[model samples]
Target: MEESKPVSYYIPNPDDDPTNERITRITNKIKIEDLIERSKRIKGCKVFQLEGRFVNLFNEAYQAYILGMDYTTVSLCALASERLCYDLIESSKITFDGRIISNIEKESFYRIPFSELVFFSKSIGLLPDKVAGKMMKLNNMRNVYIHPSFKRDRSDPEKLQIKPESDSVTALNNLIDIISGFGK
Candidate 1:
């Protein structure tokens, strides 16, 4: 199936406020730096040790958002969240339950799909209720790109506008808030 492309590729839409990018750029750098510094303190933590992996994924998603690639941004955002979920679940099991979640179980859980991760995280109280709901919304938004069946109104190519850049900024902020204080 042909993917629906954004109406404008890397072009500024006059109808949208351009100042948002400037604000996002400044805040994005600050948040990333804050996360890096925060992660540095927990040198032994799994989330800290693996920061290079999924954190980079999150950064790439942020970059995609800045470049106006909404679909790619959302897709990568979901992937980064999924990776974080796996890490958090394993870490929590080890810390709270006094057992290592086996690689087999981890792999099986990872394969179960994104929405389930949100539900599982919520059920375990890994995230606060409001954040979990936002994560669910993000997962649902992501499914529009990943699952063909979830996509609707693909016929209007011109109407396939890129999501406002602020949405990506907000998502990244939420992600940082979710994992920033781990092992703190």
Candidate 2:
């Protein structure tokens, strides 16, 4: 009978292992710094993206104004206005829930009103009544947008000659100024 050879199994040593404590410590140190730097870069990118998005929204609102599309113009203006309000609240370190000013926390003092977000801005001393009035007009335009029947004549595709009121540009520009002030 032939003698059978015994197989030897390889066992890794924990202490002298290449992937052991020493390497782990070095890797962890590098990972920590790398994670922090990555976080900072991400934050910077987020700020840039947010600014770009805000600018684009503003530009679209302006273009809608030029095109005399009242509903579209006001809709874009309201969205950009709301974004500006939220950004202001965030930068001010004010704690509130909701992604939009219209949906802010119900229990907080900073709670925004569904119909009078401009009042919240006034309460915060960020805007005067004159400025708030512009927002109110935009709010009215928002209502007009939501309730299409209120201005059905303008909505008719065949009524292409129907033009939005001249005041639309003024209202949008006022909103832009109000929001831009917050960034400064």
Candidate 3:
């Protein structure tokens, strides 16, 4: 047998957490059986009809939640909702879900905010009131993490909520519920 030093291979630093790496050593993290069971929850859920782009976003959101990438999951859900509103803009004649869409001064029409999207979506017949409210709540959850407020104070109630897992799960479930309720 020839001797090999393999000096180019990664040498772990003392300060680094070994559990953070070790892709080849997949143990000590999420157990395979547990992950399988967790994934089964998704497999068992009621399937909702989604558009092409939404399908990708929905799938990725589930995968992120399963993999414990909570922030990513929450963000994806928000993006999906935003995309839904954007699609309505593209298909319907109304602008900002209410304003009359015109050819000129395109910037104003294109600059719809997320809050407006959710609110106006409900204001019109597009989204149900409950679904629109839930979307707004989900957007708020995403904003708390994605856009941290730097007030230099401790008044923010969301800061007290430990871990992103709960928020991510909530966002994912709310999104699914909204889509499921679309028909009825």
Scored by lDDT, the top model is 3
Which window of 10 residues has the lowest lDDT sum in candidate 1?
Answer: 38-47
- How high a TM-score does candidate 1 get? 0.54
Expressed as tens digits, the lDDT of each residue in 1-184 for candidate 2 is 1134897544546757777765666556544454454333211111233443556776687666654555577678877776655555554544346344332442353355634556776786766666566567666667655664444355563542323454455457666555544444
| Candidates' C-alpha lDDT | 0.61, 0.55, 0.70
By TM-score, the candidates rank as 3, 1, 2
TM-scores vs. true structure, each candidate: 0.54, 0.46, 0.69
* Candidate 1 structure quality by residue, lDDT tens digits, 1-184: 4544676325556776767775556446555555554344322313445633677887787666655555676777767777777766655653236777665666666677667777877787776666566566567667765675664466775454335354455555555555554433
Which segments of model 3 are wrong by more than 4 Å?
Answer: 1-21, 26-30, 40-45, 93-109, 150-159
Q: List the residue pairs that clash in candidate 2.
A: none
lDDT by residue (24-72, candidate 3, tens digit) is: 4544667778667656554234766644476788788988888877889
Residue 79 of model 2, lDDT score: 73
Clashes of each: 0, 0, 0
Per-residue lDDT, model 1, residue 118, is 73
Decreasing lDDT order of the candidates: 3, 1, 2
